[model samples]
Target: MSTQKRTVLITGCSDGGLGAALARAFKDAGFFVYATARNPAKMQSLAALDIETLQLDVQSQESVNSCAARIKQLDVLVNNAGGQFVMPLSDVDIEAAKKIYDLNVWSQIRVIQAFLPLLIASKGMIVNNTSIASVAAVPFQSIYNSSKAAIASVSETLRLEVEPFGVKVIDLRTGVVKSNLINNLKETQHPKLPDGSIYEFAKDTVEKALRQDGFEGQGLDQAVWAKAIVGDLMKKNPPALIWRGESAWLSRIASILPHGLLDGTLKKLVGLDIVEKAIKEGRH
Candidate 1:
């Protein structure tokens, strides 16, 4: 009987985020957990729990290669390190948008490519932490939403490509879970509609909408969400797509419904209707 413990490596395990919570849950589930963040110091909580924490800047090829080289064995790889950008497409900083894409979309591919050898050897699973926003578009988040959508698409294609190696690919279409993603965005980016921009007339409304995306106090607890996610991932034949979090079901529903039907509701939810009215009235 093989008594080897299953090993899992998860990225973006900074404190107070989904990655960290997942590390704890995976540990409790009896798997050897490797929790990582761009800055190891941010993983103090996980380190105190005795989980092996590493520094992994997903956007850096050298960092990803170094992190992969350290792990002798891996049964699962959870790509969870990502960033958010909130601004109208017209006024968004191109470089900032590219940075988000690098972190959210390209970085996942980078890590997967770097670690594919280990995954192929174990015939393990790859879980890409995409979001409900991939399907359900929200106002002022064009770049972030599209990046997630691109990853979801990539995960689908990757599933087919990796099947021959006995590796499983899972697209985790996450809904809103309580995390510091938005708070970090607010502190670091403070995205705003530029002066003289088309959406400037709705600056307050846009900014408020950005801040109140149902993630602050309304989303599922990170630990709770992580538990459910890990439970699903640990199944004998884990599902290809798992949607678990607040409003996840709603996003699923929206994905199936006609976009025309959802357009008005989405616009109203984010106060885009008022912005449209103001634009039509030449309020800009």
Candidate 2:
């Protein structure tokens, strides 16, 4: 046992998502946990667990700073809150796209920056809850995937930058796990495509894809991933990138395939024929 009882702070801990699972696992592993979300009431169930729930709106500087001030030390910080918006690039409102990025990427950055001093003080670690989408570039989910992709790159850079300061940065590439992200996706639909838009065909495909309750692939088990993540965090030497869950290996394969192959696969899966025909015919 590492003698030192570390503290872990996780964000976006709804009742049964990855964050909540992490909170429970870390607590069971003998770490003090600060579990946070936009609404503390949503986390009422967590109150019964061995953890402290706090209010944290990652996009708000005031909220991030305030929480950072209250924590005297931190052994691990997990940026686990993020979700997808159901809007094609052509129909995507600029404000909505920005909203997705703000929560998925910038919010994680803000939380990490605000707590850097404390993490360093404890010579701790950071576990960025990134996704296979980070590298796979899924169609109809460009914004969400891209935002996570940005975080993965950021995690890589930060690992090196902060290593000399005695803090380890780990990027966790998670595959689909049973969570509320699918159920809570925000839908942004424009009845008519924007004039001269290039993505009119993508609109319908995007809608259908978003409506589908993501296939809980045999690999997408929440409890299993949670256990694996906890095991890594408790290791004597943790890996820089922890890849697990149903789609983890598959997405990694997608990331390395040639662009043509990747695009063709995505097209077939997302009903590209409908969108492509719409594009050629200029039908909004």
Candidate 3:
């Protein structure tokens, strides 16, 4: 218990992503950071800095328990390691959907459940990296959107429940962060795509959506978000939800929009109408 240094653990940190940036930010702020990923070797960059990298896969109970057992003290817990896959509901594969949920939703739950005791002991803060898609259902990404939505719900409840213990739970609504998630999309055949079906037109559109992350030129700066996150965590009592990036406001607006209007808008924005047109043209 060094009074001068804080300890923070973050999940899903590899290289060139929000997690990595957060790791650097915490280290710069004079905190001991545990940068955890499924493959500890992926976080080699942290070696040059004053950060410890650990192996943690949220989906595996053993991995979560092992990591939790090793953590004796922690000031902050950042659940930043989750990913998304975009596929039409009609074309969504059950196994792929399960895997995505395993990573995005269940993993967070496992981590929080496992590490909650330590958080309570330190009276620390929990930052759950939710997304703009949590509230707004984007075309071709129903599952990812749902998972984040679930996180937002859990964060809200956890914040209240842990308040009595002096622990803060923050729901971070992030928009368009530069990350390697695009490069790691699972490449498998869609179960809903038969020899000829409506989903055939969606293959290209879905690919683009799955690979597309962050704004083209004005995405959220990972360093900026990281610094802000650490600063907020240092506050005596930080806000419950922190919206990061330019599109954060847009997501708020979308969340309040009428269902019909929102669906129409998303369909146009994500090119679902184009896919429908292609299907009509017998492109499958």
Candidate 4:
């Protein structure tokens, strides 16, 4: 009878976020869980649960190396640390967008490359937490949307490349899940339409639409979401792509639909129809 508990390490486990929720779920599932965040102070609640907490800045090679060097065994690696940015694509802040890509896309690759030796040694799994946004083309989220799309592509290719090493890769095409993502954004920067921007006419509508879901709590409960995700990952033969959380079905549907079919509806939902009207009226 083997009594060795499986070990799992998750990044971005700050309190009130999806990573924290996932760390709890994995802990409850009886795995040895390492919950990490750049600021370890934010993970106090997780630490109180006796879950091992570490500092991990996914964007820093030094941080990634330091974190990996401490872990002696790992069965699952969840690339869950990420951020969101919302703004009109036309006037997108190139530097801000680049930061988003660095955190959301390249950082995942960096972490994977740093930890591949550990994953390969265990014949473990790599779960990349992507979003339905990757396929949905939601309004005013071009930077976020594109970054997610890029990771999805990376996960797809990495799955094949890692399979030969007996490692599994799962692209978690997440839907809306209740977390601190939006609130954190608001607290940090309060995203707004830039001054004198072309979309200024639709500023209130666009910004409201952007924050609506987060404020209204329209997503699935994070604990439930994490439980479902962990269950899938625990399967003897887990899926290559796992879609869970609120509105995940919509992402699946959108993926198969003809391109541009949802553009009009998506636009109207985010008040882009009003923007279009203003543009046609030459009111700017």
Best by lDDT: 1
Question: Ranking by TM-score, best first?
Answer: 1, 4, 3, 2
- On residues 1-284, what C-alpha lDDT tens digit does candidate 1 reach at each position? 12289999999999989999999999999999999999999999999999999999998999999988888888999999998888878888898889999999999999999989999999999999999989988878899999999999999999999999999999999998888887898888876677788766778888788775555766899989999999999999998999999989999988888767888888998899998999889887
Q: Candidate 3, which segments miss by more than 4 Å at Cα?
A: 1-4, 186-194, 201-207, 213-218, 276-284
RMSD of each: 2.0, 3.3, 2.9, 2.1
- For model 1 the local lDDT of residue 36 reads 92
Instruction: Pull out the clashing pairs in model 1.
Output: none
CA-RMSD of model 4: 2.1
**Each prediction's TM-score against the native?**
0.95, 0.88, 0.88, 0.95
Superposed by TM-score, candidate 2 places the C-alpha of residue 184 at a distance from the truth, in angstroms, of 0.6
Error of model 3, residue 271, in angstroms: 1.1
Candidate 3 per-residue lDDT over residues 1-284, each given as its tens digit: 34446889999888877899999999998888889999988888886784789999888999999998887888899999987677668667789888888888888989999988888988888999998889777877889899999889989998899999988899999876655555565334322243454565566665555445343445767788788878877777678878776578788777777666666667777677777677789876
- The global C-alpha lDDT for each of the candidates, from Candidate 1 onward, is 0.90, 0.80, 0.80, 0.89
* Least accurate 10 contiguous residues by lDDT in model 1: 209-218
**Candidate 2 ranges with C-alpha deviation above 4 Å:** 1-4, 186-205, 213-219, 277-284
Task: Score candidate 1 by TM-score against the native.
Answer: 0.95
Model 2: how far residue 263 lies from native, Å:
2.8
